[model samples]
Target: MMDGGRGQVNVALEVLADLNINIPVCGMVKDDKHKTRGLIYDNIEVPIKSGSQCMHLVTRIQDEVHRFAITYHRTLRDKRTLYSILEEIPKIGEKRRRELLKKFGSIENIKNATYEELLATPAMDGKAAQSIIEYFKQTSEA
Candidate 1:
């Protein structure tokens, strides 16, 4: 079962059909206020009782899927942002950026690290460590 209206459900059904998967596909169609109105199957609108166990289950599933999607996107965005910030530091490339993040866990930790601490990380040398220290110093000042 999917959480959407006719148009969304129809596309999913077509994709499944193309894959030769024969299974009953139903859509939890929502009304104008975004509440589930009925289940659409075989082009039929089957009303579900309000506050019923089935309705509760469908609502929970939809909420869970939305929450998971948001969390996943936020994680990806944070990683991209972190990498971009690291790239601004001279002498730091992809491999060194990865190693620093792996060792320090987060940008905040890397920023707080002492020159000796940054130098101790694998694949990091004096130049890279100094660049990181200087980059954070400049960003903090700005």
Candidate 2:
């Protein structure tokens, strides 16, 4: 499943083809006011009624897909910010950064974690844990 108008659908199809993916793709398109108006399948328009069982299902799917995509994007953005912050602390490379995120879930959680908890994370040692704690402290103080 995909979202957007004709251009986006075309791009998605091209990208998928490059990746060797072959599957039916359908797009949920929105009108100018950002209302889901119809489904575009294989370049054919399936008009959706304003209020009907089929429309209800399409709306639900569109809403859920949009929410999921936004949440995923936000998570990636947070991870990038966290990774940049972690890079400032010595000895915290990609592996350590991933371990920290996996353990604490977020940068805020990592900042609030106890020294012992930080040390308990995979690939984390006492020095690395102390560096992370001190980094957050210095940032907070500034």
- Could you tally the backbone clashes for each prediction? 0, 0
Residue lDDT tens for model 1, 1-142: 8887788888998999999988988888888898997899988889988999988888898899999999999999999999999999999999999999999999999999999999999999999999999999999999
Q: Show the colliding residue pairs in model 1.
A: none
- Model 2, residue pairs in steric clash: none
Best by lDDT: 1
TM-score of each: 0.79, 0.65
Clashes of 1: 0
Query: Against the unseen true structure, what C-alpha lDDT does each candidate score?
Result: 0.92, 0.88
Cα shift from native, residue 129, model 1 (Å): 1.6
- In angstroms, the error of model 2 at 117 is 6.3
